[model samples]
Target: MSDVLAADSATIGEPAVNISIFGVFVLITLVITFRASRNNKSAADYYAAGRNISGQQNGLAIAGDYLSAASFLGIAGAIAVYGYDGFLYSIGFLVAWLVALLLVAELMRNTARFTMADVLAFRMRQRPVRMAAAISTLAVSLFYLLAQMAGAGGLVTLLLGVSGEAAQAVVVTVVGALMIFYVLVGGMRGTTYVQIIKASLLIVGAFVMTVWVLGKYGFNLSSLIGGAQDLAVEGRDVAAPGAQYGATGTSKLDFVSLGLALVLGTAGLPHVLMRFYTVPTAKDARRSVVWAIWLIGIFYLFSLIIGYGAGALVGPERILAAPGAVNAAAPLLAFELGGTVLLGIIAGVAFATILAVVAGLTITASASFAHDVYASVIKKGQVTGNGEVRVARITAVVIGAVSIGLGILALQAGINIAFLVALAFAVAASANLPTILYTLFWRNFTTQGALWSIYGGLIACVTLIIFSPVVSGAPVNPVTGVSPSLIQDVDFSWFPLNNPGLVSIPLSFFLGWLGSKLSKERPDELKSAELEVRAFTGIGAEKAVAH
Candidate 1:
């Protein structure tokens, strides 16, 4: 442990200007966030920016929100240690965006008002539907937020050379404060612009690193692979390149499960869906998705190169000894190739990326609690635009504080960063996606159906996660210290999939279908569902129904 700390400190020696520049960026973000609040009038303005954002701008924001610390830091670290198999995760993530384009983006833009609950309740009684949807949104968002907070804590501690606990507290307090300001002052306007700027910087920084790495190897893909292959040959197992990277060799089941979670999970994320509402028309939403696909694809391709570069140049042994601290691989690569100034630029970009994503999440959660639960459900829709904005600001502060607390706890517990992120994706796909799809496509779906679907999936997913071998600290004996699985003394082996989406997503659909069938027939439900289909397709504009 002492050696590990010394190595981490050497890799991240304090740079005065680097720290100063990052501090300035935070201040600027806060200023923009406060300025954004000026235009916010009603709840719509606070939650959805009055639905006036352009497709191009909203698309950039989507990319920003989607590319969290997991994508930027986790994937690169995985590839650095695991080789080509880690790149498979990059492939899974990029392909998941396609699911969003084909199934979710345009439809979501046309359906609900500000939140997913608005769409689900359109064809059913408001209370039960809204409550269920709000709960699902909150659960998924909170899980995902915790993962982001954990990553932020880890990153700050590594970069600033502080004790992990102090770093976690600092990141949580700074990000939480900034996020509240963004939602309170800028509303959606401030959030959207920050996302665009951050996305642009991230893409550019990645591209710069990728080009430099390829040029160093003279653009020889075969030579790069050969170098990595040679390294594998000298290792203990003398395995093939893929197997050496933990690819599961011939076991196809694990691959399939991973693919299912990553592919389906993208379309189901609440924060991503909320961005669609910012665009003006269904056509624009479609266009924005296309742009996002292109942008994200380019970046993923760059990650492939960056991952290989790390393996071939920096080597895997150096990365594993301090997995959490290696978040600086991309920036470190820049320093090795071009010197301190370039490294400083890369560091600034990473800090900006973290801020943009956390702010986007903060606003999304605030909207869910305020607009969906507080006004729409609890107040019986009595709250107007300005009133809703006030409530959202209050909720943002509360959510921010919760995130800080979680971050501090995570640092103390020494949580696994990558697994925490994957858990968030699993919960979102399981508890939220099934209901969203069924409500949109199945006319027979009832309010009771949505409620059952949310609770069933949420309960199953969380329960399985708690008992899972990974979380319980009982891997297959040799790999982990447990001689017998910890849960064996208790009773069951948890659910099969490491991610609950592999089990709970299908269960959600089944429960929704069964609930709709068992409930007393409501003939009017079908008619309402058809109307929603028309409204979502822009065939008809929906009337503003009384709450």
Candidate 2:
């Protein structure tokens, strides 16, 4: 059976065809990035695309950025193996946009210029608040980038039939280099265009696959579900809940923690919040999210079919033994559907998805460092716009190199991309969200409060994660005789939950309130009033961003 699986995967994954398709996609996106770079004449152009993007266009770009490798590759794989419990990721991700749309999107567009630090530092001491926010942004972006980079390594290795740590490391390095090029040359404008193109391709590809899979199951949803269920081991129900997360008390609590992180994380995610500034007005920002919600919603529906289709056709056991493990389900399904041609196309699009996402994350992290920390805090806002942009480009290269090294480590550790993204969400929600909500709504919020929320939450969340089962102490999988934790041959973990959001999120909020009560520095009434006026009315917001 293992031999048959190996032979099938080898035949389906044609290196020549996959490489050709991958080359074509890369060439077209590079040209687009070059074209977009022509108009990057100012910091605004470099950072926020000159705020000229329309509602629909920015919406598509948001979808492109949001529908990452985790969405297409990871979630689909989860559903194929774990059944109904796997679909929870889709639900959590989609519902996250509502929190963004209602709480952050329009207000952030109206209030902030380039990054989350802009709004976060509006009423607080500029230096401290900007420094903390920048740190939090970089942390979240780094975590998110690790997942994309690791996915790239696994993805290209599978496509090219390469089998070694060195080969996978080379693949990760290439992806990191391309991502840096996109940010250094194209900036946000170029990154946005890449996302738009990638988003379109991904949606179209998934739609076609969904249709093909349904046709195979006689166009009946029930038949598809039944087919997947038929392949399940005895006493296991793929169509019912608890297949993955419900067997134990700790696992059930972990599910709740994961849900909290996902549902609240989008509003706090630095890259997602930064997308709001790419549009012209508060209305456009709101429109962008609405459009993103629609597109993202549709794609996830397609994922439902494709995931079950993979289960019915490819089987979980075959997926487990494949080169990419769970992440191989989508491509394997593509291979099963239309042979090498389809597989090539899917592989190329999947790689594009990784490239586009990492480019966005790299740009966001670099921008946060350059704008918030270097320009605002270190330089005391004395830097020129062009100088700041130059710093951002340099930062992009540094961040790219860092992500490459970490990606190789993660690949070696055999971590799941989707689970890594969930950790990123937990960090974002715990560190950023509490301060954002307090700053916007709490009248007595102070600099100390913001500091406590951002730094304290960040410290607590990361510390918990370091001590959690995700990092170590997970029991070995009986079938595979391997631990799922990022670290192996150790059991230092003491935290019970896989995700720390359930604890860290509430703790952060409490700390924010307590810090405010303890602070001797009173809130600035004039700046607070100005912030609220600008955030809700956008009266002087346009002039503030004007070059």
Candidate 3:
């Protein structure tokens, strides 16, 4: 630990070059946001980009939003240290998009106007269902935001050659401010443009790194893997499956829990679901998903090479000793590969990745509050379009501030960003997926079921998390002499597994079924019929929110 702190002060990037490249990227994105914001004359423009975004453009934007700091920084770091167990994150994330493509994307685009709650409340009692959906949406978004913000803090501090908790906190605050600006000034249109540009840069950067790393081992993947295995700590194998999660029965079960969460969670994510509404039609939504899958799939392949490359060239000891700990693996690898200049460029792209993702999350959470809770429930549909936009901007500011504080706390906890994101997925799957499935597929689904599944799943999942090893009872890392659990120093964990998904997901589904069977409040037959028709056939989808 003393050695790590001593090495943390070492320069990750030449300060002048790193700051210049970072500034240039930030300036360019700000200009793009300002130009895009010029078209925001109505609520539709603010929330859904007036549904004018093309399928291909929306696809690029979705890729940008979805491939967050977790994909680049955390997963790379995880793979560098944990090897095959780390790559599971990539597989789970990519495969999860299939659920969105098949079950959620087109139907959501056809039936909802602005937010997920718009679909949930279509046939059910509007106020209660929308309110519950809004709460669940906010919970998922905030959890996701924590990962992005923590990534921002670690990435930026390393780029600027700064160390300490205070420096990282400041970096987090600055990132939060930039995210707020993007959502408030640019809305969805500005955010989309930023995402498109970011996605391109991120993909290109990762590809270049991948190619360069491969060239070092004569372009032979086996040779590269062998090199990584050779360099791994004694008795550790980078090519095997158990470097990170295969030591015990509890660990294996935790892996199962994580897989369940990632596979089901993408379909329930409010931010990803909201992206469907940005495209003009159900066909475009489907097209967007197809494009996103191709692009995202290619990028993950690049990540596989980059991850092993880091372990091969940079090594685990150096990565673990860096300022951001495991999160520093990619940047450290860049510095090793091409010195200061390459490090600067890669760092700039990473900053852009974090900014693009957090901006998308902020807008989604704010829109759920302003559109679902405030405009629909509080104002009783009496609010004007412009009035709703104003409320959303305010909500963006509040969410940004709250996320900043949480991000600082997360950095202090020293959790991997990928692991943190998986927890967010569990919450989303438990609280949102079952209700969404029941609403779309079952005619007998009622408001009671939606409420029971959302609230019950949310409360149960969060409670399990608070008592899990992730929160308090994790064994101390021998070298660091500190528990990896978030709370530290005390063993309050009652839940043996690290993840709550296996238990909570099934409980949520059962609760939804049980609640619907017990409820005497019958759903409106006409609205239910309309939802089914519009969802399947796209009939009358243009005036979806006219009710």
Candidate 4:
């Protein structure tokens, strides 16, 4: 990507201004972290924000965590270049939250505490169920962390004109240190505050960009779209969904599979699930989802206009001219409309975006480690109070360090992580979702069933992704001439599809039922009844530990 930038002579044109704004965003978040650390004293305060975060605030934080680099930059860039198809991704993402709202939110809030393992282990055998859930959570969260860090590393280079491997390493490690602080010191309280701040700034930035984009074309939608089509240097119709996904039966199936992952995956994500535990009541969890729906919905709707704004103002050719600048479409559009000051604001927002997400992921990963693995499995539930808090902090540092190491490698490897995010979604959907639904809804669900579903989904999703054509070769970008293949010379993908969700999701559901039927153990009817009353009515539910 550095080579690509050099080849195109791409420079920030004014690095000082961008760096100053970026620095200011970091400083403010650091102050928030300092304050949050003071109030964080117990396990609940460390992991779930002390069950005191309001619905509206958590809603904004949810938006902050969910609207990642993909939503803010990648989707907008896709719309700028590919038109309507880009907006499809936003719809899929937003629609997934509906699954969480209707089926998972309140029930999860009622049944579980710090981690998803709490829910699974509530009615099942303790150690094994926890192991399965924790492993699955680590798989999904760590994979996402790697991708986010890598994207952050590359974007740091793009945004601030930071050069060389050393500089990129410093960027990732510094980000990692702050992530450690956010997770270990500030905990969920700090993460939630950062996420809300980031989400607010993102909305404000999008509003400014939308206004400029519409104003550039006199607020005429047709003219804006027409100008966008003219900016399509590849001659593909920018007004309609393109031929790439429709070009073959396999691609169409892949599209369906990707859609499945995106739509069903949110409920299963560890970080997203942990949000439920941070609120005082089940109704608060439900209301938070509603608030998230409104905020996330408005953001995606306006993002389409931002995409069109980029197309009308920046043009697809120049966006393509700078490699890895595809993600910079919206930021560059900001630069065009409102100059360096606006560009600096977007840059800061993007940095804040990555920070909130990483902090959220770090907490979830560390909590799963502390609550599920170290405390439950290794210590046999012997750990408590500051002991658990100590383990969580250590895990956060370890996770943060590993993320930085992986981020540096990613910058050097130049791997395209576009597929990794999809893979994360697919893993969550296939591996985690079935087990959650079965445990909550099925009377006959057994320990065997839960373990099989969790392990089976995890193994199946990872294995299939490794063998899929997306990891080898499926299609090339028409404009960039770069193939979507992870390996440049390899073409040995045995899997016919790009996404594993279609096969893996159903397989997970089937395995759960089969395991339940084949197991010798009987379902614990009494425990299920106990869980049932609490899950629905919030009676005898787990309470947040007071600070």
**What is the number of backbone collisions in each predicted candidate, taken in the order shown?**
7, 0, 0, 0
Clashing pairs in 1: 36-185, 36-186, 37-185, 37-186, 42-385, 42-386, 43-385
Residues 9-65 of candidate 4 have per-residue lDDT tens digits of 143546677778888998999899889878887888888888899888889999999
Write the residue-wise lDDT of candidate 1 on 22-104 in tens digits. 67767777777777777776666667776788888887877777766777766765565556666667788789888888878
Q: Name the candidate that leads on lDDT.
A: 3
lDDT of 3 by residue, 422-482 (tens): 9999999999999999999999998999999999999999999999988898998754456
**Residue 433 in model 3: lDDT:** 94
Ranking by lDDT: 3, 2, 4, 1
TM-score of each: 0.89, 0.97, 0.97, 0.94
lDDT of 3: 0.89
Candidate 1 stretches with Cα past 4 Å from truth are: 1-9, 164-167, 228-252, 323-328, 409-418, 474-496, 523-530, 542-547
What value does the lDDT take at residue 545 in candidate 4?
31
On the 0 to 100 scale, the lDDT of residue 270 in model 1 is: 76
TM-score of 4: 0.94
